[model samples]
Target chain A: MEKIVLKNVCKIFGDHPQKALKLLKEGKDKDEIQAKTGSVVGVNQASFEVKEGEIVVVMGLSGSGKSTLVRCINRLFEPTSGEIFVDGQDVTKLSREELRQFRQQKFGMVFQNFALFPHRTVIHNVEFGLEIQKSDLSVRREKAEKALELVGLKGWGEKFPSELSGGMQQRVGLARALAMDPDILLMDEAFSALDPLIRRDMQDELIEMQQSMRKTIVFISHDLDEALKLGDRIVLMKDGAVVQIGTPEDILMNPSNEYVAKFVEEVDITKVLTAETIMKKSQDVAYLTSDGPRAAMRKMKNNAIASLFVLDKQNKLHGVVFADEVAKLIEKGEKSLESAIHRDAAAVSPDTPASELFAVMQSISHPVAVVDENNKLKGIIVKGLLMAAIAERGGNI
Target chain B: MSFELPRLPLGDGIEAVLDFLVHNLAFATKAFSAVADQGIRLMETAMMAVHPIIMIFILTALVFYLTRQRGVTIFTFLGMGLIWNLGLWSATVSTLSLVLVATLIAISIGIPIGIFCALNGYAYKIVRPILDFMQTLPAFVYLIPAIPFFGLGRVAAIFATVIFSMPPAIRFTTLGIKQVPKELVECADAFGADRWQKLFKIQLPLAKTTIMGGVNQTIMLALSMVVIAAMIGARGLGGEVWRAIQRLQPGAGFEAGIGIVIVAIILDRVLQKLSKS
Candidate 1:
């Protein structure tokens, strides 16, 4: 089931009478509201769903409505017109008490500013949601302790929010959210306020936690690299509207628009894509056996091969040896098969995109090959395959 | 250096000044009584409007207890008793009663007005000048108009005191409410806090220090008007001082002035402590 859903949500602010008149006059479009009252449309007919256990990163620059969109999901700001459902429950229609219960039971929010209650201690801050939920004191405390331990702040319960560094404070905020055992976590630039070094550390910690807990998270950030690293799927927003929504791999390989293309162009795609895209396919009829220097040379000449894949007796790929490498080995009078071969080679699976393989090959200055699940050589995907893909798409190199 | 006439003896000079003050007091009293009689009913009405002193005492005690400060508790007790012991106890109580009544009235009137002004810039523009005028005008200036309407005694005294004391309370309350962090307000709203909840819980609690500051200023200004109000037969330490001066007794006048100073200090300290608490 979808964990959260927002249908046609929009938020506008101004005088009530004027707003009502404008709404009536301007009809349903956000432009009409803006034209009438000069009010900002914070979220403009936003519609999306977060599936269970999926990490959806909402990415936008400042004032792009990404923050506003996430806030609207929890009804932090009432959407001007729309409906929101959390776990199939219509949350937008909830009363105050019901909303509080919804927040306590289903939603956990972390703010960019940390928003740790200044008057509360670390453990007390973490336990704030539970306290608001009116859980038993001992049970809340116990839960808070576990949350603190989970966030790696186990021994710092007594310290006030001011006593901790920025990153530590954010961890306390994370622990606070975690203490509620929320179904969905909303993180609004939770790591952006920290120093770069600390941000990296927190990101690693978040990834580790996500691997274990598998909670649905809607993370908001402007940093492209952060989005690339943490997002299972990313929704890029601009001016209160979604520009693109796709997996990080999809975004990196094929950005939806020029804006997205420009955004992706600035990122180093080589480090992002794995070694599974460029591995070669093996020939079914032919197999590599113990062949002498002349035999190997004759095999290379006859096949018009630039490089040959090295495989074990079990047909598992060991590596590859270029023609020059074999020739060098022969020139050096190396007789052993092992001594004649170069085992270190770049290989990727069939699922890896041509764009990623191209990037990896460009970085390494070599042709890469495709491989299968059992580490057997599949087929070679050289610089030509990438060139052909890009050429076919009529895209710039 | 310039040449000058010989100075009078210190004792003789003192006696002469004392004589002048007494002459002025005797004349002022006759005028004060004439004003007092015109509104005797109003004075009684004003007295009837006085707040229960028990409430003030309880509040002071509660604040002191909460703070758990020995110095503050002692000051609260001493302040309450000193106002009673100064022979102007009944008059002081009457003035206090009127001031408290006026202040309560001011709060009811001021808070909403302040909130309105804060929310609407146009309203702020309209109210700002009136606040300025109310704050700047001399305390006695209010007496001229108040006397014509409420007449003399506690009623006029309260009218004048409220007029003088209210501006600070309203101005500061507006400022306090306006100055609440926007993000915190947003957070509260996001958590589904409606207008009323936001005002009472988030805005008011956060604005506590500034609002209390306004309260402190109002109480001090009200206390300051006690002496001026006494000239119109709003009896208090001011009347005691007026009588001592009329009888040409420097010792009596000095003691009464000292008593007024003590009351001022005690009230100031108590309010200051309350604000902190």
Candidate 2:
């Protein structure tokens, strides 16, 4: 199910938005149209959909309207034109009261600066939304307590926002939002105010939480790595227009335009690329159920490999056999390839990030066998292929 | 040739307007003065009903208990004792009555108008300059216009005192509410708080200390009007001072003035403590 859908949404910020929007639809660029109409284009005809239980990150440089786009989703900034549908209801048509109620019920937002009410105690801040929903005092308190605990602030309820550190205050903000249990979580640069290490921890924690809760979250970020780390799909924006929308790999490997290519220029590819993107198919590789060592020897020679990984018919990894071991086995008239197979074999999974492959490759001189969860040998990661992948992406720096 | 610019008849215009209102709405004026007369008599009689000696001890104990400042309590005790021993106790009580009534009424009127102006842009635009004019006007000038509405008496004095004192109350409340952080206001809106909920729960509470400052100013400004108010048939330390001035008795005038100062100081300290707490 699509949780959110925006069709030709445009937010023109000025007194005469209708006039500016008309010029925008005439194919005029933001600068040109803005100069002519005296109106700044906040978001220009942007369109995208967020799937249920998926994290969609809208990412860009400063002034890219990434922040504005997220605010538009919750109607914090009403779009000058276009339709926004959430759970099949067009939010643009909602009246002022209904819109406010919609925001309270369906959307929970975390801000860039941690916008916690400084005057309120941490628990009161968490209970604010619950209280607005008219949950009685005791119930609100219990829910607030649990929400704070979920954010790892278990017992600091009585303290004010001013008493907590920047990161903890943001956690309180997250807790405040979470207390309401809204269907969609809107995080607007939620971790950007924190120190770098704390920011990374917050990103990881958010990812971990998403794994269990499976919330549909719309996150805005200017940092590419953060977008890649937490987003299932990214909507890359530029000058209030969506330049591209794709998965992390799709964005990194096949940037659709020069602008998108420039955006990916400084991306740390090893951190983004996975084993699946680089692994080679293993259809003709050696297996334990196959004939004698001669068959393995012929397969190794044909593939120009000194060794071959052996797998059972069920596709589970049996072991590996080097050309020397197979040749020795053949001289001894060994019939089954099983006896020649080395019990211990270096292996990696298809999802193993490319950055970690170098150390694993350094630990073992042989190509790494990529295995699935059932110990099935799905593919192999050669050291040379990993190096070539790094070299190819290195120019982006 | 010297060509002179024509002077505006702004003063005449106001005087004419006041005359018209005094003529047309004398009934409202009488009704208001009656209420003020009743309120002042009630407060003064209550204070007088409590013996002066008892009032002094109560005030000192209150200062000590609320503020917990030994120096302030000692100062208050000595000050009130000096005034009571100087035989100006009744005058001091009457002065306290007039100022307290005026300040109480000023706060009641100011806070709502300030809140109204804060929430409505047009109201603020209209009210801001009115407040500035009220504040900048010389205290003595209020008496001239005050006499027409509430004819000569303590009622007229309180009418003038409220006018002179109300500006800070309005200005400060507006400023205090404005000073509430926009981030907090946004959070309040996001949580589905209606206007009243946001005002009472979020904005008003956050702006409490600041609004108290306005209350402080209102009380102080009203106290400043004691002597000025006495000129308009108002009784109190101002009346005592006025009588002494008329009789050419500097010694009595100075004592009455000191008595007024004592009341002002006690009121200021107590109010300051209440707000801080």
Show where candidate 1 strays beyond 4 Å: A15-37, A277-397, B1-174, B189-205, B232-236, B245-255, B262-277
Each model's DockQ score: 0.17, 0.56
For each candidate, the alpha-carbon lDDT, in order, equals 0.74, 0.88
Clashing pairs in 2: A287-A311
Alpha-carbon deviation at A161 in model 2, angstroms: 1.4
Clashes of 2: 1
TM-score of each: 0.66, 0.91
Most accurate candidate by DockQ = 2
Provide C-alpha RMSD values for all models, in order. 12.6, 3.2
Instruction: Give the least accurate 10-residue stretch of model 2 chain A, judged by summed lDDT.
Output: A282-291
